[model samples]
Target chain A: MLSFSEENYLKAIYHIEQLQTEGASTNTVAKKMQTKASSVTDMLQKLADKRLVVYKKYQGALLSAKGKKIAASVIRKHRLWETFLVNKLNFSWDEVHDIAEQLEHIKSEKLIDSLDAFLEFPRVDPHGDPIPDKDGNMTKQKKVMLSTLKENQQSKLVTIKDSSDNFLRYLDKKQIAIGNTIKVIAIEPFDKSIQVQIEGREFMITEEVAENLLVEIPSLTLPKVKRTN
Target chain B: MLSFSEENYLKAIYHIEQLQTEGASTNTVAKKMQTKASSVTDMLQKLADKRLVVYKKYQGALLSAKGKKIAASVIRKHRLWETFLVNKLNFSWDEVHDIAEQLEHIKSEKLIDSLDAFLEFPRVDPHGDPIPDKDGNMTKQKKVMLSTLKENQQSKLVTIKDSSDNFLRYLDKKQIAIGNTIKVIAIEPFDKSIQVQIEGREFMITEEVAENLLVEIPSLTLPKVKRTN
Candidate 1:
């Protein structure tokens, strides 16, 4: 029965810890939460008192097992709602994030479970982020950045590291999305930008965008030819 | 922009005003919100400052036009979510209320609008409560209590005045639901219990239950005659 603010703090700490490996510093949590460092320190103390986090005065804070479970559940709800918004409600990927943020706070195990069943248990959200299962188990996919692919190599867009509305809109404008097969045509040596062909359309994407787009390399299997051919 | 507490207070005030047909007294609001009278007074003052309610010392409070609009929108969200839970999620009517209560506080206009459309613009929720349109307009259906129908009269259950879980579960046990056609067979004078046939099954329900069940009378029409062989 955590407060919404408490849940949000735990989620922020979990995400920061994922990137930092070590415990998350108060300043890092503050930056992630867009709050003052002093306020974050106060909240960290509260969370520590609740045994949801282990905090050292100046070292950093890390989520306890309890806190990680809560954070995973929150993320699970968020991704599931995003899937529902896009697939059922016909909302575009770029528009579902903010709405899903609010919906993710709805606290009902039954509701979330039923929604998962209704959505056919989606493995990933519209942004290609993995959705944690009911028991908080997430299946992490192995993916490589689009920018790392070799020229003439074929791959399928699988996920996006950056799900900002602007970035999603840009991807939409380029007619790119999850599961679209793309081939790296060439790369500019000066800027490292890549030229790729996706769904019969050729486009050049900047290095920054290419770096954020995750793709799955297709297995190298030779095409079978018909006897008539 | 209203906090969850503020929205809750407004909803309580709106419901109390509907019953009292006057300004909602602090005591009434406290009773509805399960809070102290002092707390209700404090919140009413805050709402007054925001110009959402018109308040006076010990005189009670009434929602301003803006407050009414916000209240209506919250109600709309609650009903829409309830509809989704029951219809889309396959939750029973008795189980959807608390979930909908949490879902109603989600603060995205587009989300609610999309849900309304996704539910195919349902006019009433599973409980027979009217769902307010995006503009805060509600379509009021004309209905009568089941107790008002005479013996041998045919009608369809439309809504329930009481939405408590116990009451809904009772209805479920009796296999009664919205849109079920019921025909009153007889009334017991001693206890005022009525015997009714629902979907070919006969059952006796107390007058109290009947009073809370709203039903719609079908327009009179002659039965079609069969041609002679």
Candidate 2:
């Protein structure tokens, strides 16, 4: 059985690998975990001994198949719990992440499976991030940053990369949320900030915020026309 | 900020105090926690230092008001989770204790409050154990041991004192459960085993089993009689 600390290390390594593509460096893991590099190195060696990761002295570390599986399972639990908090318990999307973090460590496969079924097998969490299935398989969706949309183009908010409380509060204040139709009104080339309209309200968001917001293009459908005959 | 092990020790001490009625001895706590007496002594001292318990050398330890509050909160979480597992997740009564044990350590006041509302403020868990409220108060109920019921007396099973898996399985095999109305038919003087009728089916249970089962007497209502004209 993995200790909570060990499981957290594995999750950090998995997430760092997603951004870096190459193996995750000890310094990177340390930064993500807010620990010392030496401590991360010690943990990496332990994980390597357990066959959970492949660690090199200086080239960084990569999660083995076993490590990835555990990481994905933990993510699955976290997302499913977030979905339960928001959809069933009436918690807002901004308030569920911290609670779900603590709940993700509960170690019962039957409990998680039952929870997933009880939540009606939600495809994504309240943040619009896909939930990994029981076997650690994720259903991928095509999404682009809100800043990437052209002027006058319309799309629906699909996901938010940074789910920090402050960012979520900002979105809440702007009345922007998942599945809300947004039109890109203009872009400020000076700072790359974008002006968008949602629910007949217009707002300008910072470049960083726009980059963190993912959007999905709406499918095309012909508009109904009045009969002129 | 109590560790899980510390919380478990507090709960054990609280339970032992209930039985002893004075204070919880190191030996008794050790036996209840399945640990060494020396370890229990060390923990008691630490708890005393933290003002969670009052420990006297070679005597027994008693939980401070703060400690009792925390222990009751943990119990509340455990019973509430068990209620959710059995009522919402469709788990059998016998299968929820271990899962709830893990869940009880999750430290989030909002989560528990939301879950309590979601479960509609269940007063008792699947085992018929009263759930502590937010203020750490449990509703007192009048219950008597099954062995205390007289011959031909009918009562409903209200609680099971011993929740061990083996004991629960024994009850399951006998088709006995909480809320089952049982009528005492006879008692064997030799070994003190009692014969009971449930749903018109007769079965004999040993004195030990009878002592562990708690029952409540049903309120009597006058029977209507047809009038002759």
> Fraction of native Cα contacts kept in each candidate?
0.91, 0.74
The global C-alpha lDDT for each of the candidates, from Candidate 1 onward, is 0.89, 0.89
List, residue by residue over B101-152, the lDDT tens digit for candidate 1. 8889998888899889999999999988889998888876778889988777
Proportion of native contacts in model 2?
Answer: 0.74
Q: Output the worst ten-in-a-row residue range by lDDT, candidate 1 chain A.
A: A217-226
Best by DockQ: 1
Candidate 1: stretches off by over 4 Å: A150-154, A217-229, B147-155, B182-190, B216-229
Best by TM-score: 2
Cα lDDT tens digits for candidate 2, B109-228: 999999999999999999998999998899867788899877667888999989999999999999998989988888898998999998789989999999999998545542344669
lDDT of 1 by residue, A179-210 (tens): 88988889999999999999989989999999
- Tens-place lDDT per residue, model 2, A96-203, is 887888889999999999999999999999899899998899987778888878777788888988989999999898888888888888899999888989978998
